[model samples]
Target: MFGIYIHIPFCRKACHYCDFHFSTSLNYMDEMVDAICKEIALKADRVSGTAGSIYFGGGTPSILPATALQKIFQTLEKHFDIATGAEITLEANPDDLNAAALKTMRALPVNRFSIGVQSFFEEDLRWMNRAHHAGEAIDSIRRSQDAGFENLSIDLIYGYPLLSDEKWESNLATAISLQVPHLSSYSLTVEPRTALAAAIEKRKEPAPTDAQSAEQFRMLMARLQSARFEHYEISNFALPGQYAVHNTNYWRGVPYLGIGPSAHGFDGHTRYMNMASNATYMQALLRGQLAEERELLTDHDRYNEYVMTSLRTMWGLDPELVISRFGRSYHDYLHTALGKLGSNDWLISGDGKIKLTTEGKLYADHIASELFKVDEE
Candidate 1:
């Protein structure tokens, strides 16, 4: 099944840890919406068949008005075949999900809300420069549930300087208490050029420690698993049958259309990346042209991507599928690589698939990099 991802590149506030392409200014909201709709119509023919999921991600999709969202959906309806029960998700901040907002959202086709409630503590929220307070975070989820939007997820962050082990446990406890079906938790990474990184460089704030992050991640896993949540993906936990459909499709290499500035689309063999500049995206789309670059994947590139994404999921990478898709040579290469891993507690083979041990997950990126298929010099 195909999917579609729309990047709404505007935010009410710039979170300190975010380096995503977005503007705090709403000066061109109408124009950007128009451009997005135009981009959808323009790229309609690229992917065939019904869309199983449509995800609105980025700077804060909920920051847009219901009318703007409706207009975009109308354009999508006119151009694409969306399935009867498609999962349409909007990534929202807690501040935007007020009573009036959720009421208006009920009229739209959006069925899921991925609320960005980074923490349920006022100090933590302030540190991250998050748009909402602890109360707003709690209220927004209740309001969304009250408004009949039960399929919800919330984001939580750990490993920052202010987050002690006690506070980290409290964060997880609060999320579990909220009864949200899905949770996407991440460690605070100080990306270069972001405010967090800048502060650390100047010694204004201490950097997040790997030891702290790993400890918190373990706490997260144990707590959530005991709460009956499945650790489906490394950073995602969900109650039974409540996985994020769009992101799942992404991991499975399903073809999807990416609309709006800075969005990326993939169709098995190639990728389309839109220009990140808002003005450039709008200008190009207004002239009926796409401001995007295309990359055709090589076999090595495809294999590496597959290994990286598939290994992150609870469904481990299949060696048989590797043999069938990439031939005996690549399969042999994999066996050799597995030999190199050699009795490490990081990986386990069961049911003809190779999966990571829970502790191994902390070194997932390292392990995946080790397993990568590289080009011969």
Candidate 2:
């Protein structure tokens, strides 16, 4: 199944830890939206199959005026063969969520809402430099539910320097208490060049420790599992069949088209990303050219990508698929790597598939790296 992702690269304020391409300025919103709609029209033929999912992700998708979102959705419907029952998700921040805005959203074709409620504590919110307060975070969900939007997901960040173990537990409890259907929890990592990194360097903010992050991750797993949430993915939990279909399709290596500044698209073989700069993107689109760069994937690259993504999911890596796709050498290499990790209880093999155990998940990246095939000089 194919998917479409629209990136809205504008936020009200920059979160200290965010390294994503977004501007706090809304001056270019109109022009950017028009350019994106045009880009969508231009690239519609590129994704001619029925779309299973349409995702509106960004700096803050909810920050856009409802008319802007409506126009884009209309354009998509006009050009693409979107499925009858597709999962259309909008990533929103709590501050932008109110009764009036949610009522407008409910009238649209959007079926899912992924709220960016990173924390439920005021101290943690302040630490993250988020725009919303603790109360707004809780109210946003309640407001959505009040407006008859139930297919909801909330994002949570654990392991922040200010988020104590008790506070982390409280955050999860708040989500569970709200009866949020899906939860996407992430451990805070200070990416290079972000404000968080600079702050840590200057001793303004405490740096995130690996031990704290790992403990919080463990806590996340335990709490969610006890609440009957399915650990469908490494960072995602759902109730029953409520997985984020857009993200799942992406991890499964399905073809998708991404539009807007800094958007990335994959069409099975080649991957392309739009220019990250808003001015450059707008200029090029106005000139009727998509400002993007493309790279063709080599066999080794594809295999390694498969290993990295599949190994992290609950559905593990299928050995037979590997053998059939990448030949005996790669398969044998994987088998050897699996054997090395066997003693550590990092992997469990049965049937034709091999997946990571909970303990193995802690070192998932390291394991994938060990299994990687570097290019020969």
Candidate 3:
């Protein structure tokens, strides 16, 4: 089934490492919400059937008040046939999940909360410029749980300068103790033009090292595996039956409608990217138009996308399906690439699927790139 994604582009504070399209100002909150609702109504006919998942992702979806969120939900229900028991997720920051906030969120259709608790230490939070402290991080989860929102996921970041191995272990242990069903963790990469990258260039902050990231990732896998969490995707761990429906739909190439500035939508064969500028996005919607660019995907694009995403999951890649869907030429190309990999212990092939070994995950990007069919037909 298709999915719906709404991008909330406002945040209270800008995290140092974030380069995602967002504004620290809330001046246009009402107008932005209006524009998002309008966009949703305007694009309602794009997806034919029911939506199985609705994800509210952003600079901080929790930054919006319940009224604004409720209005958006109203618009969605009006235009789309959202499936019964659809997984509705809101990505919230720790500091915004107070008692009043949690109460309001429960009033909406949101059944899942993905809290951005990047670390459990004050120093790490401060270093990353997170809006919440260590206490709020723990309290937010407990508060949300108390509010009867148990379908919860928390994000944790590793490979940053201040995150030691011992500290990483502590972070994992704390999350396990909280009994949250899902975890999405990632390495802190310094994206160009972000505050973190600028600091690194000026020698004000130490850059994250590859070796450190690799070692910590190993620790993450072992610890989570023992805790009965499935490493279903490269950076995602979840208890049984707790996988995130929205993100899983994304990886499996389920078509979705993305609403709001800097959001993206895909319909199997094409991609739509919204304008990153908030003003531009709102202006277009005000004029009853969408400020987005659409690209028709080539076979090359589809093949690479499938390989990149499917290889990172426990499901692995099926060569025969590739042959059936993308044609024999593409499958032949993949076979040739595999031969070139030679004696590398990074991949295992069985049951007509090729999957990455634990060591191979460290080089997931490299491996996918090597397997990519780059040239034209």
Candidate 4:
């Protein structure tokens, strides 16, 4: 089934580690809402079938007003067929989930909350320049549960100097205790020109170490697995039946439509992304134009994308699918390149699927790129 993504590009504060396209300014919030609604109408025909999931992600989607969210939801209702049991997720921050806010949200169509609980510690929150405190992080989860949001996910971060092994352990323990259905964790990566990168250059913060990140990841796997959380995707852990439908569809290369500045869409053959500028996106949409760029995928592009995504998931990559879908040439290339991953010790073969061992996941990106297809001459 197809999915829909709406990017909200405004946040109350700019997190130090974020390089996502967002603005701290709310100067154009109303205009942006209008433009996004216009865009949903604009691209309705390009998408096919009922949406199984609709994800409102962002620069803090929870920061938007209840009225604004409702307006967007109303627009969606008028445009497409949304599945009755569709998974609707809103990426919310801790500070935004007070009682009144949660009350208003309950009335809205959103059924899931993906809380941005980067770390449930005071120092980590302050270091990352997050707007929430440790207490709010803890309280927010309980409060949301009281508000009846069971389809929940909280994001945690590892691999930063500020996050010690003990602190990382505390974070996982907190996540398990909360009993949130889903968890998405990632190692901190310093993006160029971001505050974290600048801080590292100026010796304000210690650079993230590969050793620290790897250790933390291993800790995460053991903790989550013992906690009975399925390591579904490399960075994602969930209780059984709680896998994120939207993202699972995305990983499986299902077609989706994205509307808003800095949003991306895939329609099987072509992938498109909107211009990142809020002003530019609004201006173009006001003029009845689609503000996006497109790339038509070649077989090489498609195969490489498949290998990269599939390998990162628990399902792994299928050699037979490569032979049938991408032809025998790609299948042969895959077997030949399996040597680059070193011994088959880290790779296990069962049911014709090449899945990575937990040890192999630390090098997943490198491994996937090693198996990438070069366009034939």
**lDDT top scorer:** 3
Predicted structure 3, TM vs. truth: 0.99
Model 2 lDDT tens row, 254-373: 999999999999998889899999999999999998989999988789889999988888888887888888899889988887667557778887677778888888888998888887
Any runs in candidate 2 off by more than 4 Å, and if so which?
none
Q: Count clashes in each candidate, considering only residues at least 3 apart in sequence or on different chains.
A: 0, 0, 0, 0
lDDT score for residue 309 of model 1: 90
lDDT order of candidates, top first? 3, 1, 4, 2
State the lDDT of candidate 3 residue by residue for 207-249, as single tens digits. 8999999999999999999999999999999999999999998
- Residue 271 lDDT in model 4? 92
lDDT of 1 by residue, 1-377 (tens): 89999999999889999999999999999999999999999998899999999999999999999999999999999999999999999999999999999999999999999999999889999999998999999999999999999999999999999999999899889989989999999999889889889999999999889999999999999999999999999999999999999999998889999999999999889999999999999999999999999999988998899899989999989999998888888889989988887788899889999999999899999999999989888
Mark the 10 consecutive residues where model 4 has the least summed lDDT: 339-348
User: 359 in model 3: Cα distance from truth in Å?
Assistant: 0.6
The candidate 2 region of ten consecutive residues with least summed lDDT is 337-346
Q: List per-prediction Cα lDDT, in the order shown.
A: 0.94, 0.90, 0.95, 0.94
State the displacement of the C-alpha of residue 18, model 1, in Å, after optimal TM-score superposition: 0.3
